[model samples]
Target: MPMTKFLKNDKGLTLIETMLSITILGIVMLGVMTLFKQAYLYTVLNEDKTIGINVARNALMYMEKQNFIEIKEKFASLGNNGQLQLLVCEHNGSARYTLIDSNTSPLSGCSDIQINDRKYNVTIETEPPKNNNSDYANYFIPLVVKVTWKHGNIEQSTQLKGVLTSEDIR
Candidate 1:
């Protein structure tokens, strides 16, 4: 009779039922936490990729501002000390603006930058002019600016390509 009474008095969860429910909830919570961790990792990686693109763009802009004829020379002329020298020459109506002088470099430059504790290695490249018969082809050169950085254990890079021509429309 006492056992029957005890069985009839059951209310809410028994110890075994409570423990099982808790275990199920813990498993679900673990899955949710793992998902959140993966999402956060992707967000950080995307941020680094975007930053790399912006860095490449800024380097391209700087290249665009340099003397169009000497952009290629400057890229190839980095000194042993790792410094890019800026060459300035003024051609008053009296002389041809030729950069092939034996005493001077054609003119190319490189620079390193850091943002948000990330270091960037920037490089510029130029290729021979394509086969366009336009008179302006002599003044055209292909340009590419690349920015690279280490994002955690992986290496990331971005590039911007363009054609440089004489700044003078005439």
Candidate 2:
């Protein structure tokens, strides 16, 4: 009988190849997780912005309920910067709230969110019309409240405007 040559060939991945594939997959997964984390942080920052705006608006609403003259006086005491003004006082007493920008007293149980190493800016503005009862006006003055904050690379603002009527004042 003649000797026959047997054919053989190496197939599938070796140990090193398997390890290299797993490493590549792991790197991809890590990158994805990093991206997800960044996105979540951005979302949280945005939520803060919204809350800051609402806080400012609520403050303004409280001011609106008071006498027109008292509005300016109380607001003056409160900080124009919005972030620093968390309290307003009258002859009776003072009310305390949270200032988004105020380093002295920040939101209760809340911490600052820094995205791209930038701090948020929250501002409030109250501008009354020069004329109290104009042809098309309802009140003596109009109060304008502006709230501003920064998220990532975008600057956002929310404004609340109301008219101060004689009826509103006591």
Candidate 3:
């Protein structure tokens, strides 16, 4: 009889029970917030990567459209006394043009690009083509384009490669 009366009077949680419930809810909310933070960070990193790759690819494609002669002419105007020479080399039985960056050393003609209000540095490197059976070097030139940017004190970069053949000269 006494137990029944006590149970009837208990209509709500005790103070300790209420505090424990509130604590558990807070912990769960903290965990969820942490997960969301990580996900957002990951998304940001992936977006940067994608942008870098695209920039490099665009640079490479631009080079691909130019033939060896055109590139030589362009570089000749840039300086180094027409030192930009393409050499033919044989590698693994295939012929390829090797790009020689003469007196310019690091070479010039790099362009800057902007994406998402962020600035990126893009550089292009050239090499002579390589092939098997022939020593003709002016047939093609290999190019590498690299894109770099600073992401929160960390440097990030991406590179893409392509070849410009003489046939492309039109």
Candidate 4:
């Protein structure tokens, strides 16, 4: 009778082990993809907020550059309604400020303008010089430009105040 020997050998991981590893890898990949998607959305929302802020700042700068006396004169013609008519203009690296009236109410042929958006109020206030002193004595008015908007269900505002004089104009 011939003697029979049994040989046991180890080669590589079993099919079940390989499949388990692949499943774990897939789960991890899904988690990473979800994280990336969220991050991308957040970045996009932030960029929109930034753009809104810039638009408000530009509007304020344009108001600042105007001749205080001229603005005052225009307001005089506007009467009490002038404040409500305050208009915004886009210029070269700045914005334009105008006053509208009931005649222009409903903002015919106008877009990209709103009194409030994102649950925040945007405002521009002018603080004229208390006294007139012609010689570098702050003859121009101080302007308060504010842009308020909402972020993540929270309201916030960005303000830029400046004391400008005729000399500051270029």
Task: Compose the digit string of candidate 4's lDDT tens values, residues 1-170.
Answer: 23342123246777887999999999999999999999999998776567667756766666666677676565456554334234544556554455444244534333334543533344555555556765534345565656666667777667667664554454
Highest lDDT: which candidate? 3
Q: What is the TM-score of each candidate against the true structure?
A: 0.60, 0.47, 0.60, 0.55
For every candidate in turn, the CA RMSD to the true structure comes to 9.2, 9.4, 10.8, 8.3
Cα lDDT, model 4, residue 80 = 44
Please give the distance, in angstroms, between residue 61's alpha carbon in candidate 3 and its true position after superposition. 1.5
When sorted by lDDT, best at the front, the candidate numbers are: 3, 1, 4, 2
In every candidate, how many clashes are there? 4, 0, 18, 2
lDDT of 3 by residue, 17-135 (tens): 89999999999999999999999989988999899899777666656665667785665465533333333345677644444554444324322466787767766665544555243
Each prediction's whole-model lDDT (CA): 0.63, 0.55, 0.66, 0.59
Query: What is the per-residue lDDT of model 1 for residues 20-110, given as tens digits with 9 covering 90 to 100?
Result: 9999999999999999999998998789778878876766666667686565455456322232322223445332222232234453332
